[model samples]
Every structure is written in C-alpha cells, then in structure tokens.
Target: MVIIKYYKGVESNLYNYKAMQAEIKNIDLELNELKNEYNGCSSISYEEKAAPTNKFNSSVENEMIDRRLKPEQLKIKKHKLEVQLQKIDNALETLSEDEMHLVELRYFKKLQFKVIAERIDRNEMYCVCLKSKIIKKLIPLIFLLDK
Candidate 1:
C-alpha cells in the first residue's frame, strides 16, 4: 500500500478557512455558555458586606471585557480568512475552463485524481500530467493575485 498527499493553489487556504470557522463556532458556543454562568454568578456578592460594591462591580466589568475580547478576536480572524478565500476565488477565475475544472475538482472539491479521471473520462496518468500543467499555469496567476 502507498499513499500520496498533495494540495495545490487555494486548497490550503480553504482548509484554513474551514478550521477558523470551526474555531469561531467553538468561541461562540463558549460565549453562550459563559452567559449562563455570568447570570448565575450575578446573584452572589464577592467578599460579603465588608467588600465595597465597587470592587465587585469592577471585577464583573473586567470579566465582561475579557469575555467580549474572544468573540472580537474571532471575528477579525474570520474576516481575514474570508479575504484569503476571496483572493483565491479571484485567482481561480483567471484560469481556462479546463484548467479551472481540474483545479476545482482537485482543490475546491477535494477529489482524488483517480475519481476525477473517472468523472472526466480520462486515464489517471493523463489527469495527473494535466494537473501539473494546470499548476504551472496557475503559479503566475496566484502571484498576480497577491498584488
């Protein structure tokens, strides 16, 4: 048995975007969970009567600030990922139809070469060779997109 793993063009960026999306979802879930914890804790006072309410209020204020920061950070990260995905899409648009189809199947749709060959009615070796050529053509396009 043998295994070969390859990803080209915007494949990595797409994977990263997916991962960041999952992270954002997790952060959102955490924030929702924290909301319940926050409500529950609000009923109790810290350090009892001797501690001024100002101290308790400040602590709660600080906690709120910390809680807000996570979602804001995740939002920024998600936006950046979206920008990268957009750039990838623009680069993809410049390719010839055949090349674009190959790239889409390989990268965007994450299809194996054998499956792609079957779908496209070509031999696997031909598909492999064509993908190499497609990647060569995309190199300059990808660079241009970065500008």
Candidate 2:
C-alpha cells in the first residue's frame, strides 16, 4: 500500500485544531441560546397562570419539547468534539523532539526548510526526510486508523 503522508505542515494543522475549538465553542453557544429561548418561553407561560386559555399551555409545551430535543442533539455534538480534541492531544504527544522542533520552526516560526536546516546546522534534505517521517507518525495518530 502506498502510504502517502503529508507531514511537516504543522502550522495548518494547528490552525485546524484552533478552528475546531472555535467550532466547538460556537456549537456550545448555539446550544445555550436554544436552551435560553426555551426557558424564556416556559417561564412566560407559567407567569401567565391566571389567563384562562389552552393557548398558553400549548405554546409552553411546544417550547418544552424543543428544549428536550435540543439537549439530545447538543450532547451528541459535544461527544464528537471531545473525540476530536483527544485526537489532537494524541498527535501532539506522539511527536519526537526533533520532529516537534522541525514542525515548530516550519509552522510556528514560518521558517523555510533551508533556513531551518541552517539554524539547526543540517542540510535541507535532512529536514525533509525527518519531516516525512514525522508526518507518517502523525497520520495514524490523528486518524486513529490501522497502521
């Protein structure tokens, strides 16, 4: 099997991680908004107890039903986000020191391979080889696929 690994681009990956986190936060905010809307509807119905009509109760019931459904959906989303977070953490852990430094220089510092190699007192080709290996290591760790 041709194991095509796209390694050494840690900046984009880290940015992707941050984007995922932002998405998770956005999801949380959406869930909270839904809950708050439900609560407002529910409380208003209760507050209007003296009004004699089935309309208020029915509206409140609809709001409650929505509240019930939303939480279940949010729970599923939260679980998926948690799994993604775990994968990112695992990828970070699996990196060797050299591999990690290479990634840091390449991604965080925005250094070219030649510059990175010069700073580290190595050839650019050496960085390329190491980066390829690092990418291979990261792929399985991030995807949780069979190696």
Candidate 3:
C-alpha cells in the first residue's frame, strides 16, 4: 500500500466532502438572500451634499455603483463554494457505482470499516485498502478541478 501525503486543504476537502456539500447549500441560500436584499430598495432616504466641483454627479449613479459593488463579498464566497462543489461533484462523478457506494458508506454514512466490510461482504483489511485506493483515485481528480 502506498502512503499518500496530501496538502492540508485538499485533505480537508476530501474528508469533509459531505460538510462541503452542506456548506454549498448554505451558500446558495446566502446568495439568494443577498440577491433579494440587493433588489429590495430601502424606503428611508437621506440627503447628501453636492460635489464641490461642477462635474455632473447624481445619486442614481452612486446607487448603481454601490449596488454593483456591495455584493462582492457574497460573490467571492459563492465562487469559492462553486469551486469546492465542482471539485467534489466531478470527483464523485468519475467514480464507479460500487466505488461511490463505498464512499457513501465510509464518508457520508460514517461507517466503521468493520461494519462497512460486513455490509459489503468483505474483510476489514480489504475495506481499508479499498478506501485508500478510492481516496488515491479521488485526489488527482479533486486537484485537477481546482485549477
């Protein structure tokens, strides 16, 4: 068996794949909230002093620019969530059904190797080795999509 040393971030992403999925869903909700907030205008109005120079300045332009720029934090967060989601999704897609099932049993369901082996009609050692192989297979796919 080969021992693979993954970068900390990649390893975390792999082990926490389910958590990342949940986070992606949360990010989607947050993005929707931000969208609604951006679209819904405030009723209260405040007065602003005119620009000192003679340049034509309007509150409408400022409001437009603010609206465009204000969601940058959410946009960046959404983009990161997208990349993580894509990495996990693409990796999972590449797996065969049995391999996916093994992953579900181990990662998603958090089964012990003994339980997984019994469920799959395999020995505990075999299950452990298979999990290593599956993770090795997944690492490249995950990093490939990171780029």
lDDT tens string, model 1, 51-107? 555554555666777678865776687576666656666766777888777777876
Q: What's the residue-level lDDT of 126 in candidate 1?
A: 91
Question: What CA RMSD would you report for each candidate?
Answer: 6.8, 6.5, 6.0
Q: Which stretches of model 1 miss by more than 4 angstroms?
A: 1-9, 14-59, 140-147
**Candidate 1 positional error at 68, Å:** 3.5
Question: Which residue pairs collide in model 1, if any?
Answer: none
Indicate the TM-score of model 2: 0.59
> Which has the higher TM-score value, candidate number 2 or candidate number 3?
3
Task: Write one digit per residue (lDDT tens) for candidate 3, span 81-137.
Answer: 778778778888988887888888887788898999999999999988877777777
Model 2 ranges off by over 4 Å: 5-15, 39-68, 105-123
lDDT of 2 at 95: 82
For candidate 2, list the clashing residue pairs, or say none.
none
Q: Give the CA lDDT, 0 to 100, for residue 106 in model 1.
A: 79
